[model samples]
Target: MQLIGLWALIAATLGPFQNVLGWSISGALVQGYDPISKTISDLAADDSPVKWIQSSFFLAGSVLTLIAAFSAKSLALPGRVALFLAGISGFGYTYFPTALVAPSPNWHVIFATIAFVLFSAWPLLSMRFDKRYHWSLRPLAAISATLVMGATTLWFLLTWLEPGQPIVGLSERVIAVMQVLWLSFVIWSQWLHQKKGAPETAPELAYGAKN
Candidate 1:
């Protein structure tokens, strides 16, 4: 599961970069378009010479993410469920390739919105205030992580909602990068906690043990 999280982090971080690079190298994309508002499906549109590259990234990443979602024992049921849906949503690009000039596309936006909301909410939903779990899963840490993620997502939405927003791409990238980093941190902390094999006792019990 830790390995899966690591791979997911890598894919999420690099996939966008690779997609943008492929599009630029192909010279088929319009200059100065908002990458975030364009939707990832736009990168895989029929007109794009680099469609295969961007499509493959989302497809492969989604499959890997689906596997990780099911296999991660560290996450609670809610988190796993949220991740499962998010992973499935990643396939929207391939399944609903948006036409380059369409005023309104199909499933792409719907799926993306679902994935974004669930991903933003999962950290808080996954919190388990138990002595047996790692500190990352504790209420305080989980709430803090959720707040940071939620705030970034809100920023993205705020920019996206504004007319002629120039920095939507930047906001989107920030949200994606932060999600990857937070997932990595949580998984790494859980991995270390497992390795240490030190069971956490309740505060009262630990104080009694000291005497």
Candidate 2:
């Protein structure tokens, strides 16, 4: 279990790292791609020259996230399910690559919105009041993570909805980074908790056993 947890941690960390790196590389490779003004989806749009590059990264990252979700046995079931759904949504949007001239509320947009909502809400969904759980899974920490991610998601949505929004890309990137960081943090906390030999559940005291 511990080894699997470690694997989960690695997957979680790599998912974010690869995504950010891929975004940077794809942006640089595609001439006229503007990281400050153009959304990452633009790099993977149907007409994008480097669509393959960005799409590949998005697929890989989503796969990694799914792997993490499956291997993270220490996480609450609700959270794990949310992560899995988010991963599925990621895969959905990647494969449905946004069309440069698509109509409003297309498949890509629908999947992306679902992914963002799940990613931002998973922490709160995973919260546990038991002392056996890691601090990151506690109510306070979970609530904080959700609030922060939710705020960023809202910021991105506002920018995305506005016509000719200059900061759409930046806001999207911010929310994406925040979601990844929080996921990685939760996974790492669980890994450390296991490493320290913490009990998964509080063991009941043996009848008449000494303190």
Q: What does candidate 2's lDDT look like per residue over 26-62, in tens digits? A: 9999878789899999999999999999999999878
Q: What is the C-alpha RMSD of each candidate to the true structure, in Å?
A: 4.9, 2.8
Off by over 4 Å in 1: 1-41, 103-105, 161-163, 199-211
Q: What is the lDDT of residue 54 in candidate 2?
A: 93
| Candidate 2 residue 60 C-alpha distance from true site, Å | 0.8
Worst lDDT run of 10 residues, candidate 1, spans 1-10
Clashes of each: 0, 0
Residue 126, candidate 1: alpha-carbon lDDT = 72
lDDT of 2: 0.84
- For every model shown, what is its TM-score relative to the native structure? 0.74, 0.90
Please provide, for model 1 over 1-211, each residue's C-alpha lDDT reduced to its tens digit, 9 standing for 90 to 100.
1222454445445544544454344334456544655544456777765677767766765675566566556778788788788888878746776565554645665676667777787788777765556878778988888888888888877775575777776786678667756665666667666666545555656787899
